[model samples]
Target: AKIIHEELATALGPNTPSYQTVARWAKRFREGSEDVNDDFRSGRPVSVLTDENIELVRQVINNDPYSIYDDIIAETSLCRGTIEQIIHNYLKMKKVTSRWIPRQLNDEQKQERVRLCRENLAKFRDGFWRLCNIITDDETWIYHRQIHHKSTNKTWIGEGASPRTIVRRSKFEPKNLFSMFFKSNGPVLIHAVDNNETIDHDYYIENCLKPVVKEIWKQRKSNGTKDIKLLHDNSSPHRHPHVINYLTEEGINIMPHPPYSPDLAPCDYWLNDYIKQNLTDQPDKKSLARAISKLIKNIPEEEFKKTFDKLLERLELCINNHGDYFEHLIK
Candidate 1:
């Protein structure tokens, strides 16, 4: 007390309480005569959050590190203050300090996409519909792993649940499936294997594509359409010299689709999603084969017709929207 009083008096003025007088007053106050000491207080005491709640927070962050505090609170039923305290005291987490990243296509790329869409539209609309028809094709691998519906859960099983025995598969099991889509036809043709080798250009041409093309030509002949066009993306097999030469000699027009333009392909963007939905809950080799067959068989003839009709509709929409759809495509 005396030291404090002396320091204060020296810092302030000589008229302040002297050190001895200040000490006498402090002694008097300490003898239960007065409440002179300032209250020893601070901001609200820190909270103690539960370990379980902290673990829950860690789990949520692990699952999705980009989630905000409010999202964590909503998911875990933890209050905002509790979450903040847990993050600050227990987790010692810090907010990321980084510049904002912008996602925007440059002007030149946008212009090129727009131009390509416009050119394709013009070709289809210029009274050469027979010669300029578009057919987008691409291949996708189908694994033979057991599949289940998104809604399936363990609760769906019986109480005395004995695990079902599954035969172990060999490493080289020929269970992979290769499929291709013809935008004009809803028939998703499944390529068959003659040996253990995966399908390449030769296999595709021999087993799958040749038959489909023949069927298309037969239909065209029946409809009295002499000029036929096929549109395919720039995949290695599709762009093979032999394949191109064969199609050229056969007087079939093959339009080359721009690379990295899957978003613009209706078969890739639309029909694939449709097919995947039907494949849910169909697992194992036998059931998968059945599901594929059922999906293909159930595609109404009118659906194929509608797909072709949508191409024209999309082309018109692209032009009317001033290539807005095309801009979205590349993005």
Candidate 2:
């Protein structure tokens, strides 16, 4: 740009190219073309715009849109610029990063998800408020760490303002495992498992979950409710035959949940995020349990109700998407 301005000033005294003019010339110069004057080639007119080449390039890209420009050039026998133009202007395809799905579902898994969503949707449509009887649980690992403000979370500042440096949060400290159980009203159980213990079938059922289930059942029975629906993910411990027998004996109905579908779960979509956002530093298991219990009790009942409603929306979304991840449609 500076060189173009100098040349313009030298050729025509007191005349300067506008910024846009200089930018245009600079773009052309940067493309490795030094000759400012256009040169006409003597031969058949050079063209890659034939219908055959365009169709051929489109077919090649339709086979695999992730193909690079070089691949398209090899297949269509067209130049890099021509391939790029066809991809961008002709076919109108834009590259996008693949989003994170919990896990890719096979055909059977997808069918099962559709079936479960349909069943839940029917039940929900019959009695919308019946979702209040649902007792859902899930476990998550809480890291003893803090997050710094990232570049994506920054804001524009005025000139001369002090510059702020972003610091990366460390995660070398010990973490704790916690499980939560709740209805659309409040938490029924929030247990932080011992740091020394692994949450296998024996530990989860015998030590943590069964006692809470009995307590919750007693509480509900005293309040004139006999049956309650238990909704948890299809984790190994949760799906064990012994655990299922225990729940059956306790009179808790295990709700039908499709495998590999966390997006449809209230705990995954809302409660977990809520807990993580409100979580503060806690030193040990006792402190973590107390903090998590307090936070769970403090959450507004209306928030949980909204989560139940979101479940309906998500089921409909899943059906619409044919069992695909529906998290992107939350907003």
Candidate 3:
């Protein structure tokens, strides 16, 4: 019986029956029984869901929202599948990780967010800024080595087969900082920050703003640069007086961006993460800047237009949510 079980296990993998089950079947077959199924005798199957069990599961989950299937199983005599069914079907709840926000807001900051969202929403409502006339930019770091997401390691296998393993790269891995600026039409400028340089007021003027302004002049020949609305975060360099003056002299309309609000920024809520996702497991590169630039240039203009449309929806949602973080609620 043991030898047969081992052989069945090797060939059938997880489908192989237990040794006791095999022995019993072998005995039955010797007595001329050829049927594989159990003899009919039905009431409720072995595992059952009772009302008392449901209430118990509810109490356990209510006490601790973070409770897992195993945690509930340890507290009750119910099986894993029963507990899962109770939580999902009965209680209408599922386990989920918390969504990350850029930062927690104080009361004043939240009200400020509401005010700015209202202001921006009014601009779109009154036809002051078309999606194509808005320019936005942000900075993010690109790690030399891409992370192997644990979720992506999942694959189809036999029930008893072990899952594939993954080890994420270290948090302090070597990386490069890259800045990207784009409009609804497409990319205007993208470049890697020099390792030795700081992104100060002077650097912002010469490297980032100047090239973008020149592009604006070329792209907006019909309306001139005055019709363009610039949207960026309230970083120290971005808020510099000299930078403001330069933009004012260039006749660029500065859009008010709330502090600590990545949820509202196009690059933060979409572009940067999209770029990082597409960067994974591809051919190795000597320069991340070149790779990101190529990717941006190759993307269809419709995608950029779609993101800008979502920006309008997000602004309205921010107002409706009373400036709460609603990026998670957005698709």
Which stretches in model 2 have alpha-carbon errors above 4 Å? 1-57, 67-92, 148-172, 214-225, 329-331
| Number of residue pairs clashing in candidate 2, backbone atoms closer than 3 angstroms, sequence gap of 3 or more or interchain | 0
Clashing pairs in 1: none
TM-score, predicted candidate 1 vs. hidden true structure: 0.53
Q: Whose lDDT is greatest here?
A: 3
Residue pairs with clashing backbones, model 3: none
In terms of lDDT, the poorest run of 10 residues in model 2 is: 144-153
* Model 3 TM-score, 2 decimals: 0.74
For each candidate, what TM-score against the reference? Answer: 0.53, 0.70, 0.74
Model 3: per-residue Cα lDDT over 1-331, one tens digit each? 7788999999999899899998998889899999988877887576567888999999998898888778889999788988888888988887788887778888888899899999888988999878888999998888877763556556898989987655677776677787789999899999788886779999999999999999887877776797888899999999999999999999987899988888889998889878877775434335666678888998899999999999999998888888888877776
C-alpha-based local distance difference test score of model 2: 0.80
Which candidate model has the greater lDDT, 2 or 3? 3
- Give the distance in Å from residue 230's predicted Cα in candidate 1 to where it truly belongs: 1.4
